[model samples]
Target: MGLFEDLSRFLETRLDEFLKANPHLELWGLEDQLRGQEQDAIRLLGDLKRREKQLEDSILATAQDIQRWHSRIQQAQAANRIDLVKAAQEREATLLRQGNQYWGQLKGVKDQIMQTRTLQKDIHDRRRELKAKIAETQAQRTAQRTTTSWDTGWAKTSFDGFGRDPMDPLEESFQRWETEQELEELKRTMGK
Candidate 1:
């Protein structure tokens, strides 16, 4: 167990360092987290809806049972059966209480459904925002890479006009001939 914990800690530390080193990965991680949260909220909403339906069914069944017991109570009274009347009235009261409890549960489930829906929406909004940021970050990184490459290319190719002359062999020959002609003209002028 100690070894496992140490390994887990090491892995976590490495992951943290890796994520810090790559910020774009962190944005993607956030987006994944938001997606997971949205999925959880959707699942909760489904469960809450199921619970609400069950509570509604329970409330309806309890109401019917209450009505049936109420009818029995009236019938017992009409028949002048006091003991049965009391029992039927108690049953009816119990059913009413049960129905109220179901209603309360139904209300709570409905509230939870609303809250889960809001949570889902919030998660979706965060994911959208993160996606936009990720897109913007990608664009900026692309532009930065392009500019860096351009600068590197220029740096590698630049001769700064003072390094080596780029003239062809023929151009060099012509330049040499022109210099000789100028020297000859200067020599002739000096002799005269």
Candidate 2:
């Protein structure tokens, strides 16, 4: 599998590009790209898991073989068969060597598993962060557009040639207070 850093950086760049394009698009394309990368990471993780399991089984089998060989050696020694004992000893040594080889392979597999897990975590985190950023940007853009539209609508609604409406003083005062309170609440909620 490719490096997680490289994959995340590539996705980040893609997201940046998508943001720089037409902002009105649905963002499904970028979402699809992220999904594909996530799938690839998952597949690689699955493969590593399988390889780890295979190595574990191999180590167990080798250990069982070593135990059997030790038993054979003990039996030969008890039977006063020196030649058979020596043969069993040699076979035990060979099995020990093979066991060591499997152990080394298992260590390598374990290291690979750790590396892949780290990569998987990093990729998952980056994907979440990127999606959050996209969502934030989209929300900001939507809010700005809504504000602009509302401003235009309000300006169009309450407009006279020269001066403003001074007729309903009580209603005007209440509306003004309500608008002020709403604006203050919005600002507070947005931490602005």
Candidate 3:
């Protein structure tokens, strides 16, 4: 048998063993386990996407606050309000710091989302490849079985050329010689 067929058979045997060991449980338990893992991965991806969006929103809001603070500082200076000017300056500094922090957090969250997405894609691709390989293995095994059956039938019928009657020793030797010559002729005709 081909490697894939052997592996598929092995997996089938293991599955049977597992089923036998867990006769009281339904087969849905295995399906549930796989579904749980898939759901967890999807949930993780959703969380990452939400976190990324929140981070981006925070960064944009921080940037807008920085701009507002700068405009307020300029207005206070133009109106010659010393106290307001100082306050605006402090607020601008605070907003700038916040904007920097938010930008850093946004970048980090984006990186994390990208990494998670890459991992998910890799896992999905591997699963598809494995499924395709299993299907290919099955096809090969089916073809091999058909070919084997054909060969067996041919072997069983091929000896009909030999007569059923008992022969003298000399005649047996001559028959063997003729059979060898015919085999050689067939080999040559077949370019073997």
Off by over 4 Å in 1: 154-192
Candidate 3 residues lying further than 4 Å off, grouped into runs, are 1-38, 133-192
Which window of ten consecutive residues has the lowest lDDT sum in model 3? Answer: 152-161
What tens digits encode model 1's per-residue C-alpha lDDT throughout 1-192? Answer: 999999999999999999998889999999998899899999888888888888988988998898899999999999999999999998898898889899888888888888889889988998999999999999988888878856654222333366633333444577799999999999999999
Model 3 clashing residue pairs (backbone): none
lDDT of 3 by residue, 37-90 (tens): 656667788997888788778878878888898898889889999899999899
- Tens-place lDDT digits, model 2, residues 72-121: 98998999999999998898898889878878887887788788778778
Best by TM-score: 1
RMSD of each: 9.7, 15.2, 15.1
Give the winner by lDDT: 1 or 3.
1
Q: Order the candidates by lDDT, highest first.
A: 1, 2, 3
- lDDT at residue 73 of model 2 (Cα atoms): 88
Compared with the true structure, all predictions reach lDDT values of 0.85, 0.77, 0.72
Q: Report lDDT (Cα) of residue 46, candidate 3.
A: 95
